[model samples]
Target: MERRFEPPVDGRGAQSVSVPTRFGLATREADGDWRDYMEMLEGPPVKLRTSVVEEHPKTILTFNTSPDIGFDRSINAYRGCEHGCIYCFARPSHAYHDLSPGLDFETRLFAKPNAAQLLRATLAKAKYTPRPIAMGTNTDPYQPIESRYRITRSVLEVCLEARHPVTITTKSDRVLADLDLLTELAEHSLVAVAVSVTTFDPKLSGKLEPRAAAPAKRLAALGKLVEAGVPAHCSVAPVIPAITDEFMEEIVERAAALGVGSCGWIPLRLPHEVAPLFREWLSVHFPERGDKVMSIVRSIRGGRDNDPDFFTRMKPSGVWADLFRARFRLACKRAGLEKPNFELDCSQFRRPNVGGQLRLL
Candidate 1:
């Protein structure tokens, strides 16, 4: 018989600590039965620890033909994000590996230590045609663990050597550490970077994106990118209804002030397991307005928790969506920000010379 599962409760200080049985077998709660009695006899709840496992995949490049996005190929140096944003759409992907889309998505991480080597081999293929490769599309390439692993940096080095065009999207200030490589890529018209900023409220940001860099730090990184002549853009993404929608104008305005060339927004999406996870998050952080917020969201999503259609998912409709769009457009106009037109030069791509020798054509 198919097992039924209920939405899991948020842990005292963590988001969705226990795995829900919705995907498969029904299991007892972490604190149920004997554990519940023991907890009553003891004091606080048990802490969930994070674990990292290294994976050496046969290949590292992921290619897609989706119409919703611009790039055809992308790379993700990590499988799970440590930033722990409650609204992450990629969380559901973890379920395919028999992992929880809740706390397990954040605590149990995977790294590709041989990513650079694999990417180098892939790009050096004799029939490989050049196109701008994208990074951080599925999971953050520069998550906290990146500092120790430096896998993303290694991939960049490979791109730099090959004169390959690349685009990056990230919410961490950690990208700033690679400013030197970014600057070089800019000179060759081979790079574009988008920094995502959801809101300026530190408290709300902390609650929503527990481990991401602060709003100010992200803005500063954008500024630094622009100052270094890198094509920097701002992403005011996943605009939550009745929660962070109000900050649409402010985020765009701040990003423009930082010299961002373009800005875009994505409405909140709760696909599959994300719907329940997000609902639980809402109840915990915005109990007073959780229902009202979901109501507005549903109204815009055709009276449903989410819209999975590609075109509709990118373009939300409704009174609230119209208002937010108007505000965003006006702010962009006032701040002199325009849609990004700069494209990375694909014709300049060259395979890196192996063994310190020149390729004889």
Candidate 2:
């Protein structure tokens, strides 16, 4: 295998690794010894790689007309993620660009350096009406790269200037860097934030989401955002059944204690490529529980790896789903939390170009 490295950028090496995509079967020795040296030779290293690309998407604002999600429009400042969460559903999206949804989805990343400028141009159009624009709906806006690029911050600067309503969702404490801006936006009922957290187990967190902030740090971030006057809620999204479900109540209680008024949970959905990638990840890290975990997932998914129907996709079916719903609702009751108040005021929207032509109220 050939390898090359570029000079360090932002303290992280800009080295790239590329591998041809292929498939293989899962097998072990007759003695059930997984670590036997010869077993290693059966599957070759796929040479996972990375490459840095500067992107400029035509439109920074993505209008989603999907009935499944609550928000109608969203923006992603970056593509491909650095956090490396094994169960990330966004993984399959990379395949559209002829990129592997495995390592390439994390290591081979792209950053849109001009997203803020594009957003400003978009909002400046005369016919454009204002509404709450959602961020971090796909790739995180506050990922590690934000510290240096600050693309998300620049987008928020435009939103602030336009008096546009904005909602943010992220797993990084880096959002704290924009506290002053968020505070000002909140005053006009124009801003809210959601923090996605799966579990409080540090060990599982390290292996599952390799580069994300520690669970403790995320909880501390929740507290800090609340204290700083940001309307923050806790989101235990894509909760893997049988793995992190056991901690549902504890997560809710912790968020409530930290002054988070709302909490919600979603069962893990392995749409398309995520199912295989997550299975590979399971075999590598949690071999013993891999089968059981997938079994429960199938139970909730109605004997399939995924259910893509609009309303039912987010809320699964079968006895397992019932049990999860019962447990989640009971936990929310005990923690004194309610379904999050996600509504934002859309009437306060202002288009910079229309102000001079005044109208009689």
- Model-by-model lDDT, in order? 0.81, 0.75
Q: List ranges where model 1 is wrong by over 4 Å.
A: 1-14, 18-22, 25-48, 354-361
lDDT of 1 by residue, 1-361 (tens): 4434345433321354454535772333433111111233334445545589999999998989889888899999998887778888898888888887776677779999999888888888899998999998988988889999999998998898888999999989999999999999999999999999999886677667767887889899999999999999999987998899888898888888877899988889888878877877877778899999999889889889999998688777899889888888898999998877778898887887654343555
Q: How close is candidate 2 to the true structure, as a TM-score?
A: 0.84
TM-score, per-candidate, Cα-based: 0.89, 0.84
Candidate 2 weakest ten by summed lDDT: 28-37
lDDT of 1: 0.81
- The number of the candidate with the highest lDDT is 1
Q: Candidate 2 — which pairs collide?
A: 17-49, 17-50
What are the per-model C-alpha RMSD values against the true structure? 5.4, 8.6
